[model samples]
Target: MITTTSLKNNRTFIILFFFLLSFIGNAQIGIGTVTPNASAVLDITSTTQGMLAPRMTTAQRTAIASPADGLIVYDTDLKALYYYSSGSTSWVVVSSGINPRLNFKRIRSTDNLATVLATELAAGGGAKYVLNSNTLYEINGTVTFNFPIDLNNAYVHGLDSNDDIILRTSGNIFEGATGGSIRSLTIRAATGSVFNLNGAATQNLIFRDCIVANSASVGTISGFGLVFLSIINFSGNTNGITYNNISQLLLSNMGWFNNNAGTYEKLTGTFTLVEKQGGFSQVDGTAIGFDVSTSGLTITGDAVLESVVFTGTNTAGYVKGYTTGSYTGYNFNNSWNVRAAGIPTETDANAVGDFSMDYTVGSGLAVSFTNNLNPSNTVKVGSGTPLTTYSNLFRFSTDAANRLRYQGKKKRIFQIGGSISFQVPGAGTYIIYIAKNGTVISQYKIYGRGQILNDIVVLPLNATTELVNNDYIEVFAQRYTGANGDIVVPNMTITIK
Candidate 1:
């Protein structure tokens, strides 16, 4: 019914149409841009417009079959971003504020704390778990803290003011690789040492504002490192304990009491003790602040003690290299004893001392120093006698109420210095003298050419003098005759090392 020429022409036309359709279907498409990559199937470029990924619930995402490996979707139910992983056969999360290991299926049952912990740790995402409540979390069998875990509301009972918890077993309870934090918690050790890294050492453990207490000798505690930040109430352990390879002990209101002694080994870090209530003290044995059994114990920081008690045979030296400030809190009920043999040994060692002083001529006749002093150490000259007439030496007397009363039986070296500026109506002489217990130790005179002149004096006062308990250091300023001593005094400081 058809000629061969007509049939061939129709077949050629169909083949050409099919070829053109295939070319159009394979052509690259671009959005918001004129240029598109030759290899790309769809390319998008825009500053104002954003390309949104597929948003779906968890069930909808799981329902997707044979999804591409790099396919990303925002899970509306979980409010998280997830990417498909062919190897995992599921969606993988992009981020979690905490470690990915901690984002496992939470076990909310009221089962035993140990059981819940074990179940959560065994689940995928590393040895991580979250505690549901403020659990007492007693050890059922041998509990091992192998990986990083967070104890959301961990607490314990039967702890004293020292914050030392009682451990049931002395055998390494918290054993792990590193990186765990016990926050807003109280860990009561029933047996002995709470943190025992005996077999394998771990590092970077934090006890943030926590209470770690114990009884019957808190045992030897060793680890790669640990940090006790702010207000740790550590007590109990009578026989004392050893802290090995510890990084730091930030002591701000930290109390280490009732422990017979402490042997610090390989503490290559800073131990800052500033204004604490009760410090490393004990009732018996060689109470060593830190024995430094192995070298590399770099001690630093300052402390001002109202009272401190240390009794029995002393064998460890006090912390070296610390600055001392005004201290009214010294309650050393035990004999104030120091180690006989140790590095930087001393009988009663304290941090370096600090004192501040300021003086100005009284408008009401008395030429005296201001009462607003620091550390309450330096006693200012009272409103004794005003410099009404020039030649009156300003017979100044210390306001006995505010003197650095010596409590020790030995004398302390003081490096004293201050800057004095004064203006005289006529040529005059001004004398500045430092005295201890009504005895002049050092004095200097400055001659003013009827003009304002400033003088700075620094002198090492005493080498050794017995100022047995209840002596004071006094400073005096004398103005010569006919000189209108209008003094603008500032900058007076004393350093005792």
Candidate 2:
């Protein structure tokens, strides 16, 4: 019933109507299968092939204009999948395997450290960066930071020497709230600048093998254990640091060279120094190594110093302790020449034959001569007097007292030997004994006899005893069985070594 041309036109019209319906309905297009997944807009399923993303070099990928967030690209330079992050405003590398370099945020001297740290914090969910202990952050140029870099409980290590990483800043460059450490770095601060500021008291901070130079002040440190090892402070306006309300401050092998101020000031707790070498190389008469002279600056505990050497002229001496404070414990040992004002110098050992006392009685005693061993006067031997031969550790009470007091800190053994020549009024027995604090020691009592009246008798007293701090020793003689008449004592000599 229809012609051939009419049939062909109807077939074309039906095909065009179906194509327009598919376009208007937003249909999914599948290449290999008739049914496509509902989640995908374009599904290409093949058994022998995979989908290929847009591949470009790092430069080409960055050159893309106005790239949308979540834009994916295969980076040929990094050999990793890169995704654009709008929050960080950079391309983030996506990898299934762990990369060691990801743990470190490499910073060049030209790079803005604040910017780099901010980006790193954003990527790390605002947590502080943890410095790797074994890694070395080599900085070639001077890195100046305006804001404080808070090292939240991490060990920041630099190159082999402090000269490699030079930091210059006007304000505080480093701070820590919890705990941290910095080693092998040189910091140069201008006026009104502090090198480090600690915020907490329960935590500790340490600095080793570092140089702090030309600063208004170092920083106020309040912690449990603040330690400085092999640190050098050069040319600063004030002291190296101030420690307040701390538990312990230990300094070992520290050198303060040509600094305008002292090494430490405002010290408030236990301080221990070992093998410390420094002095006022500038020959500042007012400079001191440990300055506690400021009013109300008191150390609450002991200060132990060992093997400390102070070279150039320091008119004020090396250390100054608070006189009215409760800081009385000072222990020094082994080649430490610390001239502390208003504090006694403590030595480990006395010189050979240094502490010796000698006394002699010139006149004779009356009847019985009970306990008359106390010398009436001192005898001069060579160019030294009786008391002059005694060192600072030993002191003679008076001419007739004949008592030696030990004023040293350590306990020592002493040998006491003397000869007493007396004429007994009647034949009997006599005893010569050593008394410590008015108590006669039974083992040191020596007995002698006088057979006839006016008989000359000699008694030798020798004893060894241990003497502690503040102990005094004396010699006494008593007539046990002699007549009550006058007993003449010709000569008596006592020597303590």
Among all candidates shown, the one with the greatest TM-score: 2
lDDT of each: 0.42, 0.57
lDDT of 2 by residue, 64-148 (tens): 9988999999987557888888877777777853322433433556766656566434533554333343333444446665555
Highest lDDT model number: 2
Model 1 per-residue lDDT at 136: 45
lDDT of 1 at 82: 83
Residue 277 CA displacement from its true place in model 2, Å: 7.3
